[model samples]
Target: MGKVKKTRKNTYNYNVDRKKLRRRAKKKSAPRIQCDEIRNAWNRSKSLAGNMAEMGLVADPNKSLPIRERTVIGEPSKVRKPYVLEGLKAAASLPSKQTMGISSDMIMYVRHMVENYGEDYKAMARDEQNYYQDTPKQIMRKVNLYKHHHTKEYQTLLASRTKQ
Candidate 1:
C-alpha cells in the first residue's frame, strides 16, 4: 500500500493580500534614500546646474533661477529677508531688457541657494513681508543677520539634508 501526502492550501489569496504583497515587493526591490545621499545629490546636481547656466548652455535664466518676488513694499522701516535681498541684488544686475547676470555669477548663486536650501520660498516671502512691514531697514538687517549666520550655523545646516 502507498501513502498519500497532502499539500497545504495558500492561506492568503493573491487578490486578498495583493496590496500588502505589492508593498512588500516594492520594499524588497527599492532601497531607502538616506539623508546624506540626498545632500550629496543636491551638492552635485546644484553645481552642475549652475555650471550649465554659467556656460550659457541653459536657456532662460528666470527658468533656472526662478525667484518669486516675496517681498511687499512697506511704508517705512521694516524687515527684509536676506534671501529676498539677495534676489533683489541679483535682479538689479540683470539687464534692463531681460537677460540676467551679464558678467558675473550672482544669478546662478542665488538660484542655487533657493533651489538647494532648507527653507521654503514661501517662508522667505513671509519673513520679507513681516520685516518690510515693521521698518524700512528691517529687510537689510535681516539679510545681514542671515549672512552672519553663514559663518557658523549655516555651515552645519548645509552639511545635512535640507528638507522643505
Candidate 2:
C-alpha cells in the first residue's frame, strides 16, 4: 500500500502579530536624550536650540556669509564654428559604385564624421556606431588608409557636387 499524503495548512495569523507590534510601538514613544557633557568632544549635540538656529530661527541669511565671485582663467573661450551646410550636403550625397575596395557604409560613416566632427578623428572613433567600434589607434589606421587611397578623389567629388 502507498503511504498516505500529509496535508499542509498556513498558521500565519495577522491579528496576533499586529497586537505584538502595537505593544512594542507604545514602548518606543519617548526617545532618550543625551547630555552634551556625557557625549564625545568631537560629536556635536543635536539639542533643540542647535536645530532651531540651523533652521535660521535666530540668524539673518544675508549677514551670515559673503558670496565669492568665480573668475575663469588660462582657458580659451569656445567660439562656435561658422555655419556648415556644405559638409552636410556632401555627406548626404551617395558615393559611386566605381570607388574601389570601399563599401558605401564606410564612405557614409567617414563623411558623417567629417560633417559633424571635422578632422577630430578621436571623436570620430569614440562614436557609438558599429563602424567606429575600433579603438582610436585602429580607427586612425583606417583613417590613414582612407586618406592614402581616396582623400583627393573624395574632395574633388565633393567640390563638383557642391558646385552643382
Identify the candidate with maximal lDDT.
Answer: 2
Model 2 segments more than 4 A misplaced: 1-100, 130-132, 153-164
Clashes of each: 13, 0
* Candidate 1 residue runs with Cα over 4 Å from true position: 8-16, 34-164
lDDT of 1 by residue, 40-136 (tens): 2332334544433333333344554447854322311332222434454676677677532222243233234434544454444444334334332
Per-prediction TM-score, please?
Answer: 0.18, 0.30
lDDT of 2 by residue, 76-132 (tens): 232121122233355448586665586677777666655555556688777877353
**lDDT on C-alpha atoms for all candidate structures:** 0.44, 0.53
Error of 2 at 98 (Å): 14
Instruction: State the local distance difference test value for candidate 1.
Output: 0.44
Worst 10 residues of 2 by lDDT: 74-83
Each candidate: RMSD to true structure? 25.2, 23.4
